[model samples]
Target chain A: MPDHPFLLEAKGLSRHFGNNIAVNDVSFSIKQGEVLGFLGPNGAGKSTTMKMLSGNLAPDKGQILINGIDLLDKPAEAKACIGYLPETPPLYKEQTVSEFLRFCAKLNNIPKKQRITAVDNAIERCGLSDVSQRLIGHLSKGFQQRVGIAQAIIHEPAVVILDEPTSGLDPIQIREIRQLIREIANQHSVILSTHILPEVDMLCDRVQIISEGQLLFIDTIETLHEYMQSSALLLRFDTEISVQQLNAIDHILQSERLADNTYRVTFAPQHDPTQAILSKSLVEQWQLTMLMPEKHSMEDVFMKILREER
Target chain B: MLTISQNELQRLFLSPLAWIILALSQLLLAYLFLTHMDYFNALQGKMSAIPGAPGVTELIAMPLLSNTGMICLLITPLLTMRTIAEERRNENLPLLISAPISIYKIVIGKFIGTLSFFLCLIVMTLLMVMSITLGSSLDWLQVLSGTLGLVLLVASFSVIGIYLSSLFKQPTVAAISSFALLFLLWIIDWASTNAAEFTLLSWLSLLRHFQPMVQGQMNSQDVAYFLIIIFAFLLLTIRRLDRERLD
Candidate 1:
């Protein structure tokens, strides 16, 4: 939906640990310069999929294409174009932040002459300049997460895949990390997997919901809401009305009393509940103050999808 | 590959465990040298009381090289306990595996870094050899040959430590396993004396192989034996790292 070329594509990607299928025929595409939010509950194969894309784990079946390059066929070239941060931050506690970043820069194959500048840029971008010399073991959880991000982006790859980047951060730290993700999205496409619903609403341009190792749905935020259509009208009445009188209307599919005077009415999708209620109110000489269709929240949709799968 | 080696070297020196190992090893070598010197003096006094006493200090004191070899065997496991084990314990193996570098390079870089630390310890113990030269008719050629033998011996044991470190993910387990393995090898050598004619265990004794070098006899077989062990273990270490990455 966003105006960008597709930077990553997974076609029938799957992973099996012995007889257990961790990821089952999952497929999705992420576009360049777009933040695609990956939402799934625990044990939903989010980490497994990310590992396959990053070349850390070979997929049992299917293909992964990075910038139209087949990952399995040309793993080195495909890996060179992407960066990944695992769910757990893989850091050596004995090493300082600067030392760890330097290792990461070299591991990513950054040129020897440019390693220092690249590491410095990552430290500045991740807001880790103050604690760059501090041992990673001594830093707080939030700063450790920042160091993890610094390692992931030190080589300046085209796509950055982060698994639960804000899993253990405080509210303020979460906000700061969210801002950092947004800043990084300007330079590279991001695939952020998180269980937090509001994070998706705040930062993601498009979302894909996966459950039970299967992709349930993929759409823009506006389109996802449209998928969860509601046929109920919420009405606030100035005059008090009995439940029996509201239910007596012939065209009413279902009616429920909200309070002393308000009522909620559900009609078929083709039926206009507001117009029907307005006509009924005029015939009954009753005043209607508010009439609006009930809209579903993203949280509601996310929960519904999860619950339905279970 | 160079970057990985540099980082491993930095970590090896920065750890407090390295300093503790160095201090303990130096203390042990000093104590062993003092005790050996006392025994040598007593033997010399006995030999002087005889009518025709050949200068046998060289032969009697040759065991010091074996003592040095034993010391190397005892300390190598501690030096290499953290090579691959610590990385796995801390879940940092993925950091190296996900890098663009090959697994062979990672293992080789770590092996060289660990060997460098062991080489430093060998240099420190050269002070003991210096003490042996004072007020005694010590054969300089024999001393030099023994020192070379000790270097090869330590290198061989360190390679075994690296291989065992890769086999286990816990540093304590790796260290204990290496100790048990080396102790068994020593016991086998001691137990095979009576049946030396048919005992294959005598051939496996690392100390037995180093004896010729300490006596100023540079046997090509001993040199080849040490080289073969080092090569075999290093190859195994490289394979272990590769298996971990694949898994």
Candidate 2:
């Protein structure tokens, strides 16, 4: 990660609304071609941090530098390197997609000569070529979201921040947008905020889970999995499995029933509990249907972090 | 700034409201011009007996310009109200704020944008006066002077409209506020006379300065008065947008 000079650096960023702290001393940076995913529950300051990063909202205390240019000291120069799409896409309903993107290109300071090609490239990239001539108000939500992203990248900014880019899209549209984000990630440093956990797994190189105005975890997805993988198994049977009988097995430290026919069995971290459980199940003929090493989902990790904070 | 201005102007033309305002105002003003022309024709017999009779320049063209100025006061808010207010309502103001542009650039860009559209309306009315070139000699200097005054006045109106639009999210609120404020500035001269020793308020009235320009008089103080109002409102808008960014 240190191999490439950082494209963005945020230090000790904090913001407040009245007496309530919205973001507190949070700091993170993105290297070139890195897509950082911001995950959080409702009211977790994800959008607040995004606003500060994009220069739409000033932090009460912090410094943001884009390519070593101080954002506060030289906002215009710094903003030139950043492109942002907020939770609500900023679009003129009366304007056609092509016209809106062209205007955005001009606003972002693309050379007027290159504006046509830049706008065309954005339309093609966001998969809006078919709807380029359509009025934005008349387009579907998915197309509007694509247009939002198209504007963000029309300038080819070094840093792109997208807040809930796929929030209201249908599943097919979400997949297309996820693919588009992946394509964008190949070239530009991206910071994406979303409630969809799998999107982080699919698109982001690293994940930052924020809760209650504080960053809870900033680590690679691989590392998150490694850190969260416990020696636990989620077992389900066609018929009921008594908890008392299940607890009798050796190496099984505890067994918590999850459903009428399912239990979450945990063993010592060092032991391979799978074999013992399989052998016992075979002996008892408990009509085993499902017994797999539990892959703790992103939701479990997020819940654990939030529970620990509380 | 130019880009923002052009986009705003382009948007103004695209909306049906601009066309309606332009077409309706022109039709109404033309009707007024013809009626005045008829009245002047009837008074032709009495004019020859007088030493210096009022001509078409005074009877028709001058009033046409003045009436068009008044129409601008009434119609400008509809055009300027959405420049920033609609952007805020549609959640597009952040696009401008986060762009590599200054708040001054935004305020000035919007001013120029609205001014350009106002210029079109003014030119359309000027053509009506240009048609007078057929029958009588026209005072080009007075027309230029009046046009300059109208420019300053419309620019002042646009600056105030942009400022109010920034403060309010709803375009309706912005439009109503601009109308009320412009009307107050227009009528302050009458209000000042009813009050005690507040004659200075007349100096603040746009009419007090505008009337002199319409009559072919160009004074530096009147120009300065309009310039000051335009500058103050534009500066206030920049400050408001800047503070909102921080907030």
Candidate 3:
């Protein structure tokens, strides 16, 4: 198992409801110790894909292998290695956190002797130890989400699939859950589906952008960062300069003056206008006081990809 | 499957609805048991004057068993309404569906969990029926046959409730639908009294099949009818759950 490269592998997954395709020919894999961010807009089939991978819903066409066991052919064995938390946490509110976790441990087929240990471990990992004895319905939304996570990891499944785990929580709860997810990534491959772009940036080692039931992009976070790098620079001159003076710089594709001395300049992707602008500013006595690259936000990268895919 | 059933039982006990229903039904049945015993006591001397009269088994135990069967029909839908429907409504079914167990196990586990509660009710009724042994000589064979009939009838009821519960997301809807279906099957024999072609319907009536066994007949045909009902509904529930995953 250590020699195997992928802990979870899904191939050509496709699912359709009546005439509408929810997921179409999507394939991806996650290696051990890797956190995969499933990014998409609403109704982009991220949840549907998660359902297929977790064995909750069957794919019309595909194969999912968890720890090298075929999921469709041998579901119970394969599912033993997968932990899933759907969009809404599947929780029985009548039970306390410990009781619910114990049930999950049993459902995962953990040995009866080890069930208590498993439940305790999950509670500790998800930061639910303090509330373990509290009723799930009485807990806050954040605590309920934590209980959801606790159940998913109770058996230490190799692949943990969580769909929007941090949705509908305050900032502190989101931070705490994100930290817990980071801890989980140390031992298990995590597939986190969320529309929150920053969540993906902060937690995922790799990213997959899905749209319209198709995977539009798949690569490391570094590649996604590369897409976030825009070919634009913000320059603030101490002296008020004319438009013609600002137009003298080389590699400047477009230029716009916001105030009397502020100029926003666009350049080609491979061109570096910073050195050219500095020299030009000195020669023209533009008295350049500020020069900074305009970085595209994660939202920009996400929207751009989605737009291009369309 | 055992884990799922245990969890289901735990859930059932956690809700106040189950406890309230359990307490009320038991109280009502106990009241009925006392009333039946009192009537039997009042008629005991008068019955001894007859040549061949019905004893405690026929006079008290069979009626109690039959009434318990009727109570089972009335209460089982409420008990089983949340078995699968609440899971769907609360969106907790994914927890089971995503687990390593098969759908067959989930359906069977829910059936067993809910049926076990009904079994408790039967046990309570039997205890009441067995109380007759302290004061009067009871016909043990007749009591055994009647208890068997009650168990089979309740099992059929529970499985149908489980099946109906699987079909809807709202527990109330599941309960109402199950009650309607059970009531229809319970009284289908009433129609056969007036129509000749309705004999088949009478044979399908759950009440008709239950009556012979409670009378100590123990006919294979009656037993098979209950067994077939239980088996068919269970299979349908399993199929519905499997189709749920597919859909």
Ranking by TM-score: 3, 2, 1
Q: Which stretches of model 2 miss by more than 4 angstroms?
A: A1-4, A227-230, A235-250, A256-264, A278-289, B192-198
- lDDT string for model 3 (A154-225, tens) is 888999999999999999999999999999999888999999999999999999999889999999999999
Error of 2 at B159 (Å): 0.9
lDDT of 1 by residue, B1-247 (tens): 6777678778877889778878987887777777777776778778788885644335444566677678778887887788888777877776776666676787878778877787778777766666655766667777788878888888788888888999998999999998887777656678675744535787787777777798788989889988998889889998877665345
In candidate 3, clashing pairs total 0
Full candidate order by DockQ, most accurate first: 3, 2, 1
Q: Write the per-residue lDDT of candidate 3 for residues B1-247, one digit (tens) a residue.
A: 8788888888988989778877888898888888888998899899999988898899889999999999889998898888889889999999999999999999999988988888878888888888888888888988899999999999999999999999999999999999999999999888765644547888889998899889999999999999999999999999999898799
Candidate 1 lDDT over residue span A53-162, tens digit each: 88878887888888888877876677777888888888878899999898889888898999999999999999999999999999998889889888888888778999
Docking class of 3: high
Number of the predicted model whose DockQ against the real structure is largest: 3
* TM-score for each predicted model, relative to the true structure: 0.86, 0.94, 0.96
User: Which pairs of residues collide in candidate 2?
Assistant: none
Sorted on lDDT, highest at the top, how do the candidates line up? 3, 2, 1
RMSD of 3: 1.9
Candidate 1 TM-score, C-alpha based: 0.86
Candidate 3's iRMSD: 0.8
